[model samples]
Target: MASNKSAFVDDKGKPLRIADSAMPKPGADDIVVRNHAVAINTIDPAQADGFLIKQYPTVLGHDLAGEVFDVGSNVKRFKKGDRVIGHARQFLTGQPEDGAFSLYSRVPAGNAAILPDRFEYKQGVVLPLAIDTAACGFYEEGYMQLELPSLDAKPNGRVVVVYGGSSSVGIAAIQLAVNAGYRVIATSSSKNSNLCREAGASEVFDYKAESIAGDIAKAVGDDQFVGLFNAIGIPESFDVVNPIMEKLNGGFLANTKPPGKLPSFIDAKFVLCIGDFGFPVWENFITKALESGKLKCLPEPKVVGKGLDSLQEAFEVRNGEVSAQKVVVEL
Candidate 1:
């Protein structure tokens, strides 16, 4: 059994501290990973500020890149010593031990994806939540529900507008949408425009420009644009999306936040990415895509500090604006 030290939160909204936690035992389909790196997400702080906790002294990590230290009897996909990356299910399942801030993390085999040797922990750690969140907005039948991405496909003339393209979810959306064969038009700060383009977006617009809406309207004119994927869930971005949605003549609008009032002409839905659905994408393509350079390690990791002690500071950094960057803590 792995004795553990984790960044523990004594209560909701409390600062995280390194503390001893019980070693998490795996279920038949789970694997215990020894985390090498962990990344912070805005949702971590948001969860801390909310009423989601069912227990105190809970762990709070989100994204992890690590090695499999042990596996359950029924787990067949991974073996001891394999390097893997996975989305911690604590927030989704409300289980403290399931978080990934510790020396070891217990995660379902389905939620874990194998990472290529060429990429280090930091490069691959940013993907789990980003990929899961983007998939929820893109493939859930109630959301965009576009066709699943295929490896051997070319552009199909369909287009998607990804708002906040440099954010973690936006980067993942750009790649996934492109893999599904749709042309992507994204919005990002000019400094990070190339990152979005690197993810396969054909055209990227500056969200700060006064003429942004007109720019998007011109590029998507009468083209088969399905809708906008709002990665930045703030209310103000709706103004950006609405005009483009109007120009597209009422397509779909999928967001990472709670669904809000939208024009009746368009289909708007809020996507809560349940972690279970993320496996298909991970098992089927993420590994290969990374190897082939189709999917990228994006919003590059901005290391907050080293060791489990740095988690609190890392979480604090996420409370402010972090454009085209993922705050990570290297273990």
Candidate 2:
């Protein structure tokens, strides 16, 4: 058995501490990944603050890229030694071994994908949580309800807005929306405009501009407006997004965080990234799109440190101001 050590949050508002963890035993539908790299999400700090953490002294993380250390009997999509990226399911399962911050993590086979050889662990590690979050915005019922992404998607003549376009979820939303045949308009700092375009956004607007809402509304003029995916999702972000939605005459609003007050005309829903909806996309779309260079691990990976001891600092770094970059720790 592989000896395991994890970065554990002993309690809410406490610093992470390194400790021994049990060697993970995969369930029939799961695989154990020996994590080579782990990506930090904004949700990690929230978890430390007791958002989704139901127990004290639990591991918390969502994104990891590694080699398969073991696979369950029922999981044929992977085997030992296969390089893979996975969405660790601690939030869903409440299991410490299923968290990405550990050296060995138990991941659902459905949420694990074979990483293409061409990509590095840090690059691929940025996608899993972002992919699921963005996909929930577009495909989840009561959200945008748009079509799933594909290799050769024809234009669907609809337009979607993604605020905070240079964010992790923003980058994924732009790519997935474009692949699903919607013309994506996005908001980012002027410095990150090219990143948004590189992700397939048709237009990039500066969020700092006073006319941002009107500018985006005018950009979608007369086009079939699908909705806005508010990747930023803070209360302040809605200051811009709500106006755009109102101008678009109350279209759908898919939010990554809790939304603020909105007019009755606007249809809004919080996107829950944990779901079965991501599995088919993982199995059928992600690997091929990656191999074909259609899917990019955008915003790029910003490696913060090496090893599990650095995870606490990585968390601090993530909580600081960051833009267009995913914080990763090499394990």
Candidate achieving the largest TM-score: 2
lDDT of 2 by residue, 271-290 (tens): 87788778878888888899
Q: What is the C-alpha RMSD of each candidate to the true structure, in Å?
A: 1.5, 1.2
Q: Which ten residues in a row have the lowest lDDT in candidate 1?
A: 271-280
- Candidate 2, clashing residue pairs? none
**TM-score of each candidate?**
0.96, 0.97
Instruction: Give a tens-digit lDDT track for model 1, residues 1-331.
Output: 4588888778767777788878888899999999999999877887776657767767777789999988999998899999999988887666767998898889888888889999999889999988989998887777787777768878788889999899899999998999989999999989999999998899999998878888898898777888799988788988777877786777788888875888887788887755566678888888888888878888789999989988888888988778888999998
* lDDT (Cα) of model 1: 0.85
lDDT of 2 at 4: 93
lDDT minimum window of 10 residues, candidate 2: 137-146
State the TM-score for model 2.
0.97
